[model samples]
Each structure stands twice: as structure tokens, then as C-alpha cells.
Target chain A: MKRMSMTMVIVLLLIPMALFARGVSEDVTTLTIAGRDGAYGDAMELAIQSYTAKNPNVRFELLKLSGSELMEQSVIELRGGTGAFDVILIDDPFLTQLQEAGWLADLDALYRKKGVAIDPDLVENMVNIGRYPYPNGPLYALPHVGNVALFAYRQDVSRKYGIEKFDTWSQVLDVAKKIKANEPGMAPILFRGVQGNPIVTGFLPIYWAFGADILKDGKPAFDTPEALNALEYFLELAKYAPQGVTAYQATQVSDALLSGVGAIAIEVWPGWIGNLENPELSNVVGKVKIAAHPGEVKRSSSMIGAWMVAIPKDSKNIDAAFDFLLHLTSAETQAMISEKNGVPPTRHSVHKISSLVAMYPWYPAQLDGQISGSIRPRTNYWAEIESVFGDYLQRALVGNLTAKAALEQIQRRVTEIIER
Target chain B: MRNRERAVYSSFFYIVFAPALLIILLLTTYPMVTILYDSFFRYSFVVNTRTFVGLGNYIHIVGEELFQRSLINTLVFTLVASFSEVVLGVALAFLLKRQFLGKRVASLIVIFPMIISTMVICAVWQIFYHYEIGLFNHVLTTLGMQRVGWLTDQRVALASIILVDLWQWTPFAFLIIQAGMGSIPSEIFEAAQIDGARSGQIAVKVTLPILRNQILLVLMLRTLDTFRLFDKVYALTGGGPANATQTLSFFIYREGFKFFNFGRASAASVITLVGVAFLALFYVRRLLGEEE
Candidate 1:
């Protein structure tokens, strides 16, 4: 009995010291990254796997969250002065807000201290979005996802409609009508109907092509004759849309394309179109041609939806976070992520990679779109204005109000938001 | 001699209760105080700036078209959905009170919706409410009727959301009413019948009277809950087909969480809080008056 008691006491005494050693090591080497879910999440996983393999002692805790959830958590945590996250993922639309609030550390300062510069392959426009005051503003983030919206059409179907090249919104509509008439089950056009970002992004090309600007001198420019014509044309084209088109979101549009039910998709982001050429995953593989949006009043209008990586201003491990950021945006890491996780590459070099090109035949189109894409007006009220426009636009689409009525309503509501 | 012991025991009681009381006070009162404080500021989330501007946010919110529409939408949704839930719940509970074949299966099916998460339920219902190939439209077309734009029509979008809420949450009220009904003895019904009262008469005179408090309780609970409708609007219509389905919670979510305009969001929230408080206090006072 005495010996057993003595052994038990020895075991108890050793456990605390072991725990102390483990805790001490854990405090120093671990990196916490807040990234997005979906394809972006997959990309982060690949980067982390590669980074950890190189440095065995270093580890990571990745929070894979939805876009809105990631933004809210980053803001709340950073504002609360919790240096809990070393790196954060931000949507392009929220970059201005993050930059203005100083939630993100200045990447230029980090680079100067590290004696390194941002890699040249990352596009200038993409890098510019990560800055405050934009363009020549201080670098605060890096482009992680090069999301630019492109147009997609079935090669065979477009031929049947005798639509050789879409140069105008009117031509696209003409093609859509012909496709619907010729093809019985296939929808001529499909767009995201799930409201907010989906609907707003889907309509942006048409809105821009109509020669209507979203903002003019810090005021809503939606109340115009061009905007009205665009709405009418959109509604006219809606006749050929599927019956439940109002409720159609990204999943529905993608499903419509993959199942051979949709001939033309007006808005196809890189993330959603990455799997289009995979025969096992797609029914219409190798049959679709993707291009930038057709131009009308101006040049082809493409919208950028870049997702960026930024270190919160309150980060405890800014040095380690910048190290991970560099590794994540490396050409080597980008290529691996494209291959394994199907994250759309942001760098120009990745598009030239033979393997990735083979994976996405639309890589050339996506590249062109990114090169010439027009980003949404970077107003602080973009979120509110987008909501207002999307709501009324759908209202008109559903025949709840006339185009005139809808535009007037949106104008009145948006005027107040901008005025404030 | 034991006075010192009594003092120690009293101190222990204070120590134990103090923490819980403090926590409750912070949880319940802190948010309310913050909202009240923030409503007076011109809050800009991007600038990370707040300025004192008394009644400015309130004036802005009340003057905005979107806010006005959302207020009306919330008020209508709360009254209609809550009343319907209570009436339907009580009706179902009355019918379910008796023993019958397949009663167990019926009960299970009735409670199935409440078991699922709101997002999942909204997804399923969204498909059902689809205009082209939805189950609801499918049924209508099969009967040689015109297809109704269930969610696309602004006039009907709010009503459609209420319909979905009813489907998912009626079971909650039903369960509550059923528990309340079970507590009333069989002897009460027997005695009423022994006095030559018909089943209908017994239900009207006795069963309803006994279940009045439960019905009111469910109504009060559901009214307050429905007043904050958000998830369904988000998943389904997104306050679209016009601002026909915007609710107070959605307004606050947009201004606060989405845009981080703390002042405006707080102003909107305070209005809702005041409205809900008025209703809750009314019901509580009525309950207390009945007791008195």
C-alpha cells in the first residue's frame, strides 16, 4: 500500500510539469488565421499545409467562416482590442471601410521592416484596392482571390441563334430570345436572384453598359434615362428566364449550366465557373465559351470582386502573419492551391501555367476580364445603395411596380442615404 | 454565542447571490443602456467616429421611406402571424387531445418542422414557394389554375413569409397548448357532461376557459418573437419584390451589423424595444390584474 501511494504521488507531481512545458511551447509558435469558407477556405488550407510542411514546429488555427461572418467578427474582435487573429480575410467591398478604420496594418511598413516588396506578378489594380484613399494609397492588404465577373455562353447554342459576336446588350437579348425559341428546355439566360450581392453584381454589367453610373460626385446617379432603359431591357429579357428566376442564387445558376438547362449565364464569377470544364462534374464540358460582358454605350464592363488578406492593426504576431501572407501569395503556393483546391488564381503567371489553363479553358477570358474590369463605386454607402437598388429592381422584375416607379422609389431612398 | 455563525452564513448567501445578480444586471441592462446612449450619436463605423447629435438618427430613421415601410411590415407581420399561430395551435391541440389510430405518427409529423434549423427550413420552403417549378405552383397548375407569383408579388411576399413562419412554429404553440390541456382533469369534463352539456358546449364553457391563460401566454410569446422576423426575409425574399417584407430586425441588421452605423441601428432598435416593451407590460399587467 505504501509503495502504490508513493508511485501515485510521483505521477501526479510530473503531470503538472509536463503540462507547463506543452503550454509554453504552444504560446510561441501557433498562428491564427481568419479566412473565408467555400473555395477560398480550400485555398487557405492548401497554403497552410504547404507552410507547415516547410516549418514543422510552426502551426496554424484557421477559422473558415462565411463572408459576412468573417467581416463582422474581424471588426468586432479588432475593435474590442483582442489580438486574437493574426491574419484576416476581407471582401473587396469592405476593404475601404477596413482601411479607413485602420483595422488593417500598413503592409508598406511591414515590407520596409522586412526589407522585401510585394511580388510584381500581382496586378497593380488588385493591389491598389488594398489601400486607403485608393490608387496611390498606403498598402494595407494583398489580393488573395482575383474574382472578376465574366459572361458565359454555349458555343453550339450561340451558333444556332446565329449570334456571332455579342457587342451590345441588345444583341445579347436578341440572342437570348432566339435561344429560348429554338431550344425548348434550355433557359436562354440565368442570373443570381438571391438578393443583395448576387442580384446587384448580376445587374452591374447591364447598368454600366447602359451608360449609367452608380455614383456621380458622391451622389446616386441611378435616376437617369439610361438607367430606366436598362431596367426595361432587363425586364424584357426576363420573359425568357426560368419561372423561379427571382429566387435563383449562385447554386441554381451553376446547376442550370451544369445540367444543360441554361444556354447563357449573364454573370459567372471565377469561383463558380472553375469546375465547368471538368467532364465528370459537368454535362456541357468543353462546349461553353466564356468572355467579358458585351459592351453597348462603352467598352466591355467587367466587375472585380477581389477578396484580400489583411493583418488587423491589433495583431500580436504581425511579423509571422506577413510571413504567412507572403507564402500564401507566392507563385508556387498559388499554383498548388489552383491544382488542389480550385481557388481561382489572382496572379497573371498562374493563368499561364499549362495545368491550370487545361483545368479552366476560360482562364484567358477571366484574365482579360480582370485586366479591364470596372470595380463598383467605392463609396462608403455602397452597401446601402446596393440594397436599395436591388430591392426596387426586383420589385420591377416581379411586376410589383413599373420601371419608372421603381427607379423613382430607389432614387428617393438613396438620396436620403447619400445625403446623410 | 451563535451570532457570529449567523453572520458568516449571511455573508455566504450574499457572496453566492451577488455574482448572479451582477451578471443578470449587466446582461439585461448593459445593452439597453448602450443602445440608448448610441441613439444620440452620429456614428460612422468606417471613420470609427461618434458624435453627439440628439434625435438626429431618430429623425433620419423615422423619415426614411425604407424604415417607415419596414415598421409597417413588422407590425402587420407580428399581429397576423401571432394570432394565426395561436388559433391554429389551439385548434390542433384540441383535435390532438383524444386518442386515435396513427396518433403517434401524426404527433411526430406535426412537431417535425420545429426540430429543424430555421435556415434549413427556409431553404426547403423557398423551393416550395418558387414560381416556376415549386411544389405550391405545381399543385395549382395541376388543378388548372393560374400560377400565382408567391414570393415575387410585393402584395403577397410578406404574407408568404408569414405562411412559412406559421408552418415552422405552429407546432411550438401546439405543444404548449397541449401541455396546458393535459393539466385539466378528465373529471372536469365529466362533470360538465354529467350536467347535460354537449361536447361543443363543454369545450366553449369549460375547456376554453381553462385554456385561456395558455392561449394568451402563447400569443404574447409569439407576438414578441414574430415582431423581430429576419431570417425568413433574408433567405427567401430578402425584403425584395419591393420593401414588402422588411422587418425591424432586418433594418437593424443592415444599419448595425452590415453597415456598422451604430447610431441609426441603435435608434431603430430602441424604437422596436419600446414597442415590444409596451406590449409585454400590457400583457403582464393584465395577468397581474387577473390575479388581483
Candidate 2:
């Protein structure tokens, strides 16, 4: 009798364990995505909801992290081949490193398996960034956030200064000087002068416009005269910036522009100015003009800062992730996200959508920038390179180092990083 | 029987302590060994490449200007912030040792900053240090004084961060000193009073001597904590306005996590660990001497 009762209890425990196991293994396919937080997070959440609503068997576990945190976690996981994340969001510049390392899945093979091709609606330049080699390589990722660095100016202030157009960096500097002299209370120029990515990113458009290549023929090119001129002009423009411009981030720049306290912003990402047109939030709603960066020695060179989505090579559910990625980047979904979350769309059709264009008046400018945007050099050492470059650049900006000295230091350090 | 009992006791002790020892070895010693190993190689985490280049990473990092600057900045921050915190803490503890009304409330207020999250504290201070719209600049302007670039000026940026550290961590030192003071016999104060010792004399000659160990303990703790300054620098200045606030921890983070140059980062970490261990040894030796 005792043995029978013990066996009964064991059987009862086993029943629930079996049921629980079955519950987990049942047709539920949970796709885990490591994505960015903030607006991108919101957009991902929307896409996940829509995706799950259509496919009842599919669930999602989304890890929304900051840019740095995402990079750190993804690198650790991908390098270990842990397959912890099925999909990841990578900043465009970091995409090169990941692709070169063979950490990302071959999307070309997946597309071939699915009997589909990359949609033509996605901007070629934006999509090309997902490739490893410059413009033609095996696709490893897709552009999710069509981010391009653009310049912003107070149109009213520009007109008041009798500036019909800002065609050159020198012209912009002249206008800034005029604005600074006339409007003592207002900051005539603004940029993210904070060290590292912020300062480097803010300086790139100007750097490229001055015909300076960050990497010329696969080597550090900061020692060139073009880079020196760019830095000199940037310092001149800095004279008209706020006293604490070196501490400024995206928030400060956007706040300065929206408060109508700044005449021009040297760099403005689409993500930062999503609320620029919101009348309640902006004092300069109708006054600001967003456009591609003006030229100096070269034609306009807007820096591409798109965020890309990729399936990790070790992903357990490649087909599911690829399906979700396609859905997420589709024109319909992009339009929805663009309309609701103000996430800049990767698709040209979404950018041209009447509603989105009306909402984001700079949609045309954004599309143009995306088509013509220049991506940072596809080098594995970009993170280190950008850091060294930004450090010296900021030192020069704060009068710690002269422009020539800063470029020389940057060139030396970058050369060291490359050689290592 | 005693031997048998001792054997059983030893077995019990081993049973209880072995797992913990193993965990500690795995957690601390394993990482240290790995870092030491990695420091000798040219490893790039992003590229998944590791090439053995004995001492090359160390030599390269030591030669780098930024690494040297970061080391100096970290040492300066550690000394200034830690010393300021401990001294201010002792002063506050001395002030609070007396029986006074609202002592509990005052103590709570004193420890408030210490209890708040570091990121939150940094956020609050970021606003306070803003040049145009900050509370400090507002007060300065109201007083018809020139506005200071609390964070934007390289000369003042690190000091500005140190001030924030003082604000947040002085309370911790105060708490330690206060606890030490509380443990001291009230009769000692009474006896000192009877011997005609004034308040300042008693504090300087008696109380301070008695509180030397606690002060040293606080100093060691604060020194170690301030030596790894990353968050405030990250949130406030991003080690900027010309890398004035770039601490060793920030440097390691940039190299290891941001750039994925594991070899260089490991070398930097080993160097930092050695510095911290030396500092700890000096304090521990002094503490042990005091105990003896």
C-alpha cells in the first residue's frame, strides 16, 4: 500500500511537469531581438505587435537597449556564438566590423531561399551600407533607421542676414559672424562639441565638405590640408556658439534650435528633430529650414548615420527573423511607423507618402540626403579612429590644441590604431 | 574523541566553505588571470582575432598619450575627491556628535545624497552645472558675477566632477565617522571636560585620535571608489572639454567595450589593478599598524 501511494504521488508530479514542458514546446516560436531604445524601441514594439497579431503562433522577446549597451551585448553574444539573440540592430558604422567578422547571417542566401529580391523602394545608398564592401557585397543587414546628418538654419535669420543660400562653409561662417555681431543674445551657431561620437559626427559633414577623407587609400588622412582647413573653419564657427557648447548633446542643440535661440545648427539628425515641427513644442516651428550640408571644396556631403537590422549568424530561427525583418522594413510598416513614431523611413515610397511628407516637411531633403549621403569609411577600427579624432578635435575646439596640432595628433593616433 | 570531533568539524567547515572559495576563485581570480593572459596578446573582439605579442599591448598602451593622461586624471580625481569627502565627512560627524534637536532629521538629510542613485545625482548636477541655465550660473549672474564653464572648461571640469563626488559621497564618510563616534564612551568626553579640555582640544587631541581607524577606513574606501570614476564623467562631460575627466575606468570602457580592443583594454586594466592594489596595500598596512 505504501509503495502504491508513493507511485501515485510521483505520477501526479510528473503529470504537471509534462504539461509544463509541453506548454513551452507548443507551437509558440518566440523571436528574440536585440534592438535600440527610444524612438527605435517604440517602432520595434509596434512592428512586433502587428507581426504577432497576424501570426498567432509567433511571440517576441525584445531587448531594447541604448546604442552602447546594444553594441557591447551584441558583440559579446555574437563573438561567443551564443545564439542568444535572433536579430540585432547595428549602427551603420559598426555594421562594417560585424560583417567583416562574419558575425551576421548571409541575407542574400536567405533572400534566394525565399525567392525574393531586395525591394527597389529602399534607398540604394541606405541599403548599400548594410553590405560589407563599399557598394556591392553580400547583404548582411537592412536599413531600418534612414538617418542622415543634415544642417538646420533659422530661415528668418538667414533672410534677415541677406543670405539667399548657404552654398559654402565659408558663407555659413560669414553668416554666423554677421548673426553673432547683430544678435548678441542669440547663439549664431550650434553643434555637439562633446567628445567622442557626438563631436566626431558633428564635424564629419564639414570635414567631407572641405574635401577631407577620414581614410584616404586605407590610411589616416587627417594630416591633409583639407582636414586642417575644416578644423580651422569649425573653430571660427565655434566663436559664435554658446559658452557651454562643448557640453552640448542632441538635446541641447534641439532645444536651442526649437527655442529660437540659435541661428544655425551644424549637425541635426532626423531623430533629434522629430518634434521640431510640433508647434506646441517648438517656438521656431515654421522658421527653421532643414537641408543637406553645404559644400566647401566638394559638393554637399551629408553623413549617413542609418541604423541597420541584421540576423546573427548563430540565430536559431533565421527564417523567422528574416520574415520579421522584411515586414519591419516594408513600405506599409515604414509608413505606419513614420506617421506614428516619426522614425525616418528607409523606403523612398514611405518618404514620399503625402501624409508623412506633410507631417515631416523635410522629407524631401531627407530622401535626397539618403540618396547622396556619404557613409564613414568601412574600417574595423572606426570606433577607435573616431574616438582619437574626436578627442583631438574637441581639444582644438576648447583651445587646448591648435587646429594643426590637433589634426597632426589625430593622424598619428589613427595611424597607430590602423597599424595595430 | 576530541580528535574525532575535530575531524568532523573540519569536514563541516570544508563542506561549508569550499563552494564559496570555488565561486570566489572563479569570479575574481579567473577574470584576473584571463586579463593578464589577454594583455600579452593583440586581441580584437570585433574581428575575433587574437595574436600573441608578448608585452606588445602594454608597451603600446603605455606609450599612448591618452592612456597616460587618463591615469594622471584618475589619480588626481582619486586624491582630491577622496580626501575632500573624508575631511568633510569628519567635520560633519563632529558637528553632529552633540545632543541637539532635529538631529535625526539632520542625519537623514545628510545621508540623502549618498542614498540616491549615482546616475540620478549626475543628472541633477548636470543641470546645476549648465553654463547658461544652471543653478550655479543663475546665482552667479544674479550676484552680477561672471558665469563659469563648470563642465565646458577643461581646467574646471574635473574639479566640477570632484565637487559632485564630494556632494554624493561625503555623507558615506560622515556615516562611518558618526558610527565610530557613537561607539566611543560618553564618559571619555565627561572626563576630558572635568580635566578642563575645551571642545576644540578634546576633538583634536582625543576624538580625532580615537577616530583615526574609521577615518583611514573611509579614506581607503573612498580612494578605491573614486579611482574608478566613470559614470559621472560619462553622463556629465563624457570625459570631454578636452578629456580632463577621462578616468582609467572610462579609458578601459572605451577601449574594451566601445572599440573592442581587448588587448589594449586588458593591459590598461592590469595597470589599473596594480595601482589600486598598491594603494590598498598602503592603506591596509597603515590600518594594520594602527590595530597593532
Candidate 3:
């Protein structure tokens, strides 16, 4: 009796395994994608629904994760050669690391196999970010989100102060000072001042505009005079920022802008300020102007923070994933996603659509930033460099370290990271 | 016949316990050994490089100023938070020892924070800590005082987090101590009363002496838990305002997951583990001495 029962259990387990094998051999194809959450996830869901409707035989398993979670999971799966994820989203900064590791599929070969030329509708600068050895290399991913950091200010406030336009960092500082002295109830300036990524990203445009490169000829340039000037200027401007700004994030900055409590924001992202035109959500609707950051020693230098989609080299459904990738980035799909979800589109035609441009009044400025913005230095150690630089920068902002001392410390740490 | 039965029992014991013992070894011992081994190398996930550099990772991590700050912050948090929680827990336990009207409902209310999720608690507190619109600042404004930077001020951020921890975990210590108090014989208190002992004297001389083991256990658990502080700092401050709240676990997380520098992260983790073990040993020794 015992032997018979054991045999029964064995057969029951094997039966499911046999059925699963048969199911895999059948015609149905399931493509697994590791993507982002929030509005990006909603956009991916819309695309998936549209594609599966057109191709009835294809199915999808979408894993919506946060940015850091997506990177960690994708890296682990790719490194293990699990063939678990067919498609994955890579944050622009992490693209260099993944591409350099040779974990991503070669999109150039896939394009050749499909006998289709890369579409020019896609913005050239956005597409260039997906290539390793950067500006020119084998294509391994396609731009999905055309995110760029821009400056925002209350147009009415600026007009009241008799400032027509802010063309220089000095002008911005002057306006901030005036707003602080005049408007006692409103915050003069706003930006994410939290340590790590928030503070680093907010500071980059000013740093670049002041002519300080994080890496010059593959070495740390933070100890230079330009860096010192930028940090000093930032410290001066920070005095006008909201109290407890060191804990501020995107939500806080956007809240301050939308509520008409902030007169100017030194840093704003396309995703964060998408509702600025809606009066229901924003009290400052049509009252705020978004533009490229003001220049100091150079022209306005915006920072590109795009998100890209790629296929893993060990994917089981690479062919189907490539087809979905193309469909996902096509002008029509981009337009649909952008109109419905307010996700920044990567295609020029989509950005030029009259309906989208009407909804997002800053489309022209966004597209301009995308075309002429600066990408962070392409280095595998960008994450470490950003963290170290942010720590010291926040220290200076909070009066814990002098600006020159902060720059010196950042220079020393970044040099150590690169050497390691 | 007895010998044969003994042999059979021993065989059955091995058969029943082998799988569990093996699983424990795999889950605990395996990773610990692996971490120890990895600490001696320079492992970069991006470059896919693993270079053996004995003692180099430990030396480098120990020499880092941030690591030193994180260690000191962790120690301060553990000592202050854990000590406060245990003392408050014992006080509450004594207060509730005698039954009164609404005692059951009061106990439930006191333990509410412990039952709720930490993330949810953090979200609620984040709003309460907001500079301009928080409840505390509103009260302060109404009272004609200045608003405080709860999470942004370096000097006060760690204390704010400790308040949150004490609010959430004191009930856990209370529950354990209360149970221990219940298990003690009531006759001892009556006997002390017959000898003219006051309530305060009885609590100090009789009750506390009897609850030594329980209090020590609570201290040990709370200390070990608080020593590895991560979630509160991650959600509240991100170790900001000049790294005032940066703890060892946050440092290890940044090094290991954010940067994927396994060797340095492993070394940091081993050091933290040793520190926690030492703390646990101190409490355990106290408990054992009380028993003796």
C-alpha cells in the first residue's frame, strides 16, 4: 500500500511537468518584460494591450518595478543567464554599465536581421544614449522616455519683478534675492536638496553651466576653480531655499510649484511637472514657464535623464521582444502613450504633434533640451561618483563643510572610485 | 531488548532531524562562510572581476571616514533607543499589572503601533514631520514658538527616528515583561507587604529583581534590532544633512547593492555582525549571572 501511494504522488507531480513541457512546445509565445512602475508602468501596459490585440498569438508577462529594483533584478538575471526576462528597461545612467558588461543583446544585428533601417523619427540624441562607447557604437537599446532636467519659474512673479527672462545664473540669483525680500509668504527658490541622487541631479546643470566637468579626459575635475565657483554660487542660492529643504524630493518640489508657494524652481523634470497645465491640479497653471537652465560660463546646459528599453542576451523570446520594441517606440505608439499617460515621448514627430504640444506647452523646450542637452559622463562608476559627490555637496549646503573643502573631498573620493 | 529499542530510537531521531539541521546549515552557515570568503577579495559586479586581496578590503573600509561615522551613529542609536524602550516597557508593564476598568482596551491601544506596518507608520509620520504643515509645528505656532526641522536638522534627525522606534517597539518589550510579571508568584508581594514594604520598595527590591532575566532578554533583542537600523533612515532622511543618521546597515546596503562592490560590503557586514554579537553576549552574560 505504501509503495502504491508513493507511486501515485510521483505520477501526480510528473503529470504537471509533462503538461508544462507540452504547453511550451505549443504555438503560444509569452514575452516577459522587466519595466518600471508608476506612470511608466501604465504606459507599458497600454502598449502591451495594443500589441497583443494586433498579434493574437503573442502574450506578455510584465514585471513593474521601481528604477533601482529594475536594475538589480535585471543585472542578476542577465548575469545568471536565466533567460527569464525578454525585455528590460535601463535607466540612462545604468546603460553604460550593462552595455559594457555585454549582458544586453546586440540591437544592430537584430535590425539587420529584420531588414529594417533604424527610424529617423526617433530623436538622434535620445537614440545615441543607448549606444555604448557612446556617440557611435553598436546599438543595444532604444529610447523609451525622453526625460530632461529643466528650470521652472513663476512667470507672473518674474514679470512682477521686472525680469523679462533669466539668461544667466547671476540673473537667477538676483531674482531669487528679490523674491526672498519681497514675498515673505512664498519660498524664493526650490530644488531637491536631499543627499545622493536627488541632490546630485539638481546640482549637475549648474555645475556644467559653470564649466566644471565631473570627468575631464577620464579623470576627476572637481578640484578646479570652476567647481569652486559653482559650489559657492549654489550655497548663496540655497540660503533662499525653503527650510528643511535637505529632505525634499520630486514630490516636495512639485507640490511647492503647483501650490504657487514657490517662486522659482532651479531644477524640474518632465515627468514631475506634467500636470502644470491642468488648473484642477495646479494653481499656477499657465503661470509658470519651463525652460533650459540658465548659463554661467557657458550656454544653457540641460541634463538628459532618459529611460531606455533593451532585450537581454539570454532571452528566450528575443524575436518577439524586438518586434514589440519597435512597435513600442514607433511614432504612433509614442503619441498614444504620451497623450494618455503624459510620458515624454522619444520620437520627434510625436513631440511635434499639435495635440501633444497643446497639452504639454513645454514640448518645444523639452525637445530642444533633448536635442542639445548634456548626457552624464559615460562611466561604469557613475553611480559611485554621483553618491560621493552628492554627500560632500550636501555637506557644503548645510554649512558642515566649506565649498572649497567640499570640492576637494569630492575630487579625492571620485579619484579613488575611478582608480578602484 | 532495551538496547535494541534504544538503537531504534536513535536512528529515528536522526531521520527526523537530519533535513531540518541540513536546512539550517544551508541557510545560516553557508551564507556566513561565503561572506567571510568574499571579504578578502576585490569583487566588482560591473567589470566581472574578482581579485584576491587579503585584508585589503577590511583595511580600506575601516579607513573610510563615512564608515567610521556610520558605526558611531549606529552605536549611539542602539544605546539610546534600546535603553529607553526597555525602561519605558517595564514602567508600562508595572502600571498595567493591577487590573482596572478599561484595562483591556488600554492595553490594546498601547500595543497598536506594534501591530501596524512599519512602512505605513513611516508614511504617517513623514507628514507629521513636514516643516510647514505638520501637526507638531502647527501646535508650536499656536503656542507662539518657532517650528523645528524634525528630519532635516542633523542634530535632531537621529533623535526623531529614535522617538519613532520607541513608539513602535516599546509594546513588544511590554508584552514580554508583562507575561513575565504574571508568571511570578503573587505570594511574594503579599509576604513583602506583611513585612512593611512599601509599593515602591517592593517594585525596586522584589519585582525588578525577579524580572531580571526578562528585562535582559528584551534589552538583547531590542539592541540587536536597533543596531542594524536601515528602514527608518532610508524612508526618513536617506542619511542626509551631512550623514548624521548614516548607520552601518545603510553603508553596507549602499556599498553592496547600489555600487555592487561585494568585497567592501562583505567586510562591513562582518564587522557589524561582530558588533551585534558582542552586544548580545553582554546581555546574555547578565541574564546567566542573574540565574546563578
Per DockQ, the best of the predicted structures is 2
* Candidate whose TM-score is highest: 2
**Colliding pairs, model 3:** none
lDDT of 3 by residue, B1-292 (tens): 9999999999999999999999999999999999999999999876679999999998988999999999999999999999999999999999998889999999999999999988888888889988889988889999999999899989888999999999999999999999999998989999999999999999999999999889989999999999999999988888977899999999999998889899999999999999988998898888888778
Off by over 4 Å in 2: A1-24, B1-16
Tens digit of per-residue lDDT, candidate 2, span B107-217? 999999998999999999999999889999999999999999999999999999999999999999999999999999999999999999999999999999999999999
Give the top-scoring candidate (lDDT): 3
Q: Order of all candidates by lDDT, from best down to worst?
A: 3, 2, 1
lDDT of 3 at A219: 99
Ranking by DockQ: 2, 3, 1
Q: For candidate 1, what is the DockQ? A: 0.53
Q: Please give fnat for model 1.
A: 0.61
Candidate 2 residues A302-409, lDDT tens each? 888999999999999999999999999998889889888999998889988897888898899899999988988898888889889989999999898999999999
Q: Is candidate 2 or candidate 3 better by TM-score?
A: 2
CA lDDT, every model vs. true structure: 0.86, 0.92, 0.92
The candidate with the higher TM-score, 1 or 3, is: 3
Docking class of 3: medium
